[model samples]
Each structure stands twice: as structure tokens, then as C-alpha cells.
Target: MSRRLLPVAVLVALVAALTASSSPAAPRQRPRAPSGLAFYRPPARLLAGRHGSVIWSRPARGTLRLAGAKRALVVLYRSRSLTGTPIAVSGTVWVPKGRPPKRGWPIISWAHGTTGVGDPCAPSRDSPTSLAHGYIDYVYPELSAWLKAGYAVIQTDYQGLGTAGPHPYLIGVSEGRGVDDIVRAARELVPALGRRFAIAGHSQGGQASLFAASIARGWVPELKLVGDASYAPASHIADQIKLVGAFTAPSPISALGAEVLYGAAAGSPAVSISALMAPPALALMPQLEVKCEPQLIQPDSFGGLAPNRLLASGANLGPLLALTGRQNPAVSIPVPILLAQGGADATVPKPFTDQLAGELRAKHDRLDYRVYPGITHGQIPAAAQPVFMRWVAQRFGRR
Candidate 1:
């Protein structure tokens, strides 16, 4: 009886060992995106819904400790999609290191530029990581200066860049909508924010900042938008297409093309990105989505577009272009506009800016255009920050 019990005990231990060996182990956790999206995968529609819109009210406000300066980032307004959907559109009101304005002050609608042309991941547009990567990171120096001067700064992390949605590529209306909505959102946070506002930006944002005034009437008619100061903005897509072909430096065609595919996937009604690509391209989307841009997708500089076997990947670019040119052909809105351009701006070439200046001149005599001699695309704002800030301050009566 003792021997039989001993054998049974050994068998029970063996059974336990086998069971432990066969069990599946838990998955190791990975670091979340800086934006806190590693664990959350909310659908665009869900985020755009009523409950989603409410999330705008519950912003995670905190102080931004940076470069020995701890600035406060107050979430002034959370926006809803104009598609009548509730999306988490957040705008941060950057108050300089001073008490709130005892007297009314002018507002500066600080529209940011694009670092990457990709959706949500673009450094210029996205908020969380944007601070480290794109134009905003570079311009924070100027923003710091603005804060020191005692002015109210309103910065918006436009639709798809900081939040979610198919980044509307370079579409102007979408960009303008985000800019105008954010300005109104900022002003609503404080009544003194209504004195008068100026729009300022660089590169794509330059186009956006200049065009935002034209679009403000349609998106938010309540804000008292007095003027716009656009720096080296682009108006001619045809020209940008041409410049990409001539660019001798390393280009971003393939990545840019992938971004186009993603935008096409998000904007179209009948197509899905999964349904659009060939096997290899589909597999490439996960990694390349952030890196892809339409310009790189082209087979050659002289060629039209690469034949994307993608069903919706080849979605019509008309709406996209129309949305981008929303304020083009020059409007007679007569908003006091100050236009600055760099002579050597290759990205949004001088010709494009000159064309933009020419178009604006034909449209409004009050428009001011300054073409910096020998200044390149990126150097325009840097060389002109003091000039630009002075112009911005003048509109607010601080100059």
C-alpha cells in the first residue's frame, strides 16, 4: 500500500509539471506611443461621435517642463469634427510667464508647419511628438520669445496630425478649418482674446496661416480676425510637383506616395486600404504609412503617377486638390494680409511664393509682400522672426 501511494504521488507531480509546461505565457508589454495610443485603438467614427466630442471637455492638462522653463499648457478648447462628429480636436493656449492680461490683449493664432507629410505621424502637425521632430520644435524658440513679450498665443494641433483620422494630406480647407476653429476656440476661452488676431506660419503652415483668414468667415464667423502674416507660403501645386522632380537632394517620393495611399484610403467612400494594395505593398503599409508620401510613389520625376494596383489607393485627387486650394484664385475678403517669402525657398519655390504674392496682389492692394534677398525656404522665418514678430505685435497694438 505504501509503494502504490508513492507511485501515485510521483504521477501527480508529473501531471502538474506537464500542465505547467503546456500553459501559454502572458505577452510582454511594449512601450506606448508618447501620445498614449499604444493601448487605445478607438475608431474614427467612435471618436467623432457625441460621446467622443465630450472627451474634448476632459483634456489632460498639465505643465510642460522644458529647457529649464516650466510653461503651462492650458487646454483651451477641444473640438468636434465638422462632419457633425465628435473628434478630440485639442487646442492649447500658451500663456507667457506672466499673470493673465488685466487689460485686453491681441491674440496670435500660431499655426504650425509639416515635418513629415504622413498622417498622424507628421512632426509639424502632431502634438505629442511634434515638440521633438518638426517645424514646431524649431520654432519653439520664437514661441518662447513671443511668450516673453506678454502676448496670448493659441496653438492648434490640427485634425489628423495630433489626434486621429486620415490626415487630409495637403488639403487647404481641412487645414484652414482646423486653424480657424482653433482661433475661435482660443478666443472663446477668454473674452479679451477677441481684440484682434493675426495668423502666422511657415511652409505649408504659411499657406494655411495666410488662407485661414479667408476661411474664418465660413468656419467661425464670431472671431474678430483682423489680419494675416504668411511666411513663404505655397499656392501652386503644379509648381511643387515640378520642384520635386528637380530636387537633387535625397527625396521622399516613396514615403510621400504611401501617405497619399493612406489619405486616399481614408477619404474615399468605396475603398479600404486593405482592399487596395498588392500583397507586398499591403505588408509595407504598417511601417511605411508614416514614412510614405505621394511624391515618392512616382516611378520617375518625369513620369505621371505610378500605377498603384491599389483600388482606392488611386482615388481621385480632385477633391484633395480642391480642398487644398480652398482660398486660392485670391479672394476679395480684404483681410489685412502680410506676405513674406524667401528668395531661395526650394521646397515651396520662390516662383510659387512669387506667384502667391502676385495672385494676392491682384486680389488686394492692402496686402504686403516682402521677398527676402537670397533667403532660402527654411531661413525665411528665422531671418524674419523679429520682423515677423514685430508685424504680429503691431496688429495686436503691442508694437
Candidate 2:
């Protein structure tokens, strides 16, 4: 939430926090891309694997290591886009040390928040320390806590981040598929991973987890989903878009709108970046090649740009807006859901989540919505751990 400038390019280097040792050492640099993926070419065989099928895997070293995991592996697996075309997705999985329960370790499909659409920005390839210590407390103690409870964790980098394709960014279906397929791939790679699992995420991942809940059964019916937890999820995209359009000064929300508009353009053949953004903003798109969230939200990136200037005057954004809403629909979920929001979150305002809670309730979806009094978006995942864990434990039969 601090708008003050920080070195954004080094976000990947900050992965040193993932190390088990607490020494105040320099941040670990991001590991290099495997030689097989040197040019972002997934093997042709990877494209033919069924969704959630693992094509290849390698042990992750350097900053990709997990603190309490007995083993962590970087994997490339098969998944689909919103259009259902075959695509390769990448992620990392960490299995706890010690013997598994009789039923095997339950899985936590951790959908990550936005980083960038570029391959180098992939969290599985970069440093997960960002989750543990980066811009936000998005996936730390929650991930480690679950690991300590003897659960396996599968963290997806979405479709485009590590593999070839336009990362759909906030496109919920694409993100959700990434989450679902990773869990499936992990199960196949390690037969000991449990079929019963929960989906949890923060911010953009939160929204993705919800969509996963809607599709998990049909997409991968073999898996048994217990419940879901979404923390400060990106909801009400259309409403948030309008709010971003109204911002005069540079704002983080506007940056999100820009990034999302860029993403929509990437995923849709009908949508074009030129049509969605003014020439000035359009010209800046190249900068996104290397920058992810940390750099994109910087005031310097905006260059005094406003969200209203992002589109052609009077352009029909209805298609794009409709796509956003459709990708993140509000259909009733049969499984139990827990949504935690931060009252002080300026990024994902409280009202939006509150409205979502109301709609979900009206639909009779089982929900446990909690809003921390003074927490901000970045703090919600860590701060809400107690209640969050208790709920998950109940779903896990009082673990």
C-alpha cells in the first residue's frame, strides 16, 4: 500500500525469505529457467497430455525451495485456456516431511495473485519468498501452517507466466483451470497426494479460487474438494473498472485496470490493445515485457496516465466488461466458502466484497465472510490465519 518507490525489478530477488534459516542474509536471486524451457517452447508432448496431466518436472533449487516441505518440484503440466484450447501451465508443489496419513496428505491448491503475464515473472520460477515476504503477506504463514499440518501445497503460476501463451491475468476461468490442473498434475506426479483438498488464494487468486470451486467437479471430477478460502479477492471488476476510470492521480487500482485491460486484449482475438488504450498508454505496453505488479504500479510507470485515458473515447467496453463478469460469475457454489476481507484495503475496497457476500447469501451459498477491522489487503492473509485455519480444520474433520 505504500506508494513510495521501491526497486520493482528486484522483486524476484527478494525470494531469500523462503529459506528456513532466519539469518538476515541478502535476498536470493531467482533461479534460471530450465534448459528445456530456454526459449519458452513446451515440448510438443506436453500439449497432448490431458488437462492436469504432468508433462515434465524437475527439482527446484535456489530460491524456489520451500521452508517446511520435505520435497519441492517444479512442474509443467497440461491445462486449457478460457477457449478450451490446449496449453501448458507451470507451478511448484511441496510435500511435507514425515509419513503421510493413511489417507495421504490433503492438498492445498494455492492460486497466486497477479505478478505479471511474462514468463520470467512466474512465481514458481521466481521466488515464492515474495508470498512469504514480498509486497504483501499473501501466502506465507498460511502455506507454511498448512504444511506443518501435514498437507501438500501446489502453487500455480497460471498459464502464460511460465509457459507460452498470453497469460489471461484476471480471467477467472484460465486462472481457475491453472489451479485445478496443477492439483491434478501433482496428484499424478506423486500418487501419495490426497484426493481430498481445499482451494485457497489471495487477491486475484482469491477470485480464481472461487471460480475453481464452480468448475472443479466437472473439470477434474476425480478429486474431492472440501472447501475454499479467498482473502481480499479481486471482485466486482466492472465496478472497480469504473472507479479506476474516475481516478485523477496515479492509483494502484488504475494500474490494475491497465493490467487487466492488457490481459483481456491478450486473451481475446476480438480485443486489441490499441482499441482499449490511448496511444500514450498503448506505447507504454512494451514496458510490461519485464515489469510485473511491483513495477507496473509504480508512479513512474503511470507517467501521469489515468484510467480514462486507457481507452478510445466512447469506445464500447461492453464486450470486455462482459467478459470480465462472465469469467468471474456468481453462480451458487455447493461447497462451504470462507471469504476474508480487510476493512482498510484500498485496493479491493470493503464494499465490493460485502456486496459479493450479500449476493452469495441470497443465492444460499454456504459462506463464512469475515472482515478484519483495521487490516489492509496485504495483511489479511496473515492476520486472518487463526479463523482461516479453524475453518479449514473443520472441513478437514477437525484436523
Number of the predicted model whose TM-score against the real structure is largest? 2
lDDT of 2 at 333: 75
* Candidate 1 RMSD computed on C-alpha atoms after optimal superposition onto the true structure: 19.1
Model 1's TM-score against the true structure? 0.68
Q: What is the C-alpha RMSD of each candidate to the true structure, in Å?
A: 19.1, 14.4
**lDDT for each residue of candidate 1 in 182-266, tens digit (9 for 90 to 100):** 6555444444444456777776677667657776765554456777877776566533332333433333343444444554445
Can you write out model 2's per-residue Cα lDDT over 183-223, one digit (the tens) per residue?
A: 88887677678788899998888998998888898887767
For each candidate, the alpha-carbon lDDT, in order, equals 0.54, 0.76
